[model samples]
Target: MNKNCAIVTGSKESAPYTLIVQTTWIYPGWFAGLMKQHAKVTTLLKFIETANPAHVLLEINSEKAPGDFDFVGIPNSNDRIAEGYAKTAKSLAKLITKKIK
Candidate 1:
């Protein structure tokens, strides 16, 4: 697995370690590239264990970029695909510290 890692800090509060992982997954055209190819419950958990991230900000592109869709508290499985991603994001937050940074 090829992993890309970076430590980013903004202001005093938004400094944390960020990891950019490239895997094999596709969604919409706009945000398809941003999806974590290796993003799985186990994978994310392992990352948290290894990185010990203070605040994990999963971005489709870069830490400064925003997501393609507006996330609202993890979408219903049947509601939308993006919702599921958001849900995964939320769930991952519990195991790891995550926020906009």
Candidate 2:
């Protein structure tokens, strides 16, 4: 299994205001690429619709929020690597960050 490290930080929840750190794994790629796929997006949206949280914090490698995790370190077949997959993951991460706030 390919493993991409994701660090979740900042969670301060009150009765009225809730803060959460949601650490989700994106196998073989970052979060955005995972969501861009039609099937994957559908699945993710379904999960979001079901588990509606107050706030969320996501950690992914991006220019805005550079992550310490390395996608190449994951144990995945070379053939599965897509072009600009990392950016996609970053984009997804951004979306999650927005939803949290």
lDDT of 2 by residue, 12-93 (tens): 3423333322333333333453332211111122121113453333223322222223453323322233222443455655
User: What are the clash counts of all predictions, listed in order?
Assistant: 1, 4
In candidate 2 the C-alpha lDDT for residue 87 amounts to 39
lDDT for each residue of candidate 1 in 5-76, tens digit (9 for 90 to 100) = 133223343424444343333342222333422212112322322245554544342111112344332232
TM-score for each predicted model, relative to the true structure? 0.27, 0.23
**lDDT of the structure predicted as candidate 1:** 0.33
Deviation from native of the Cα of residue 7 in model 2, angstroms: 6.0
Q: lDDT of each prediction vs. the true structure?
A: 0.33, 0.33
RMSD of model 2 against the true structure: 11.8
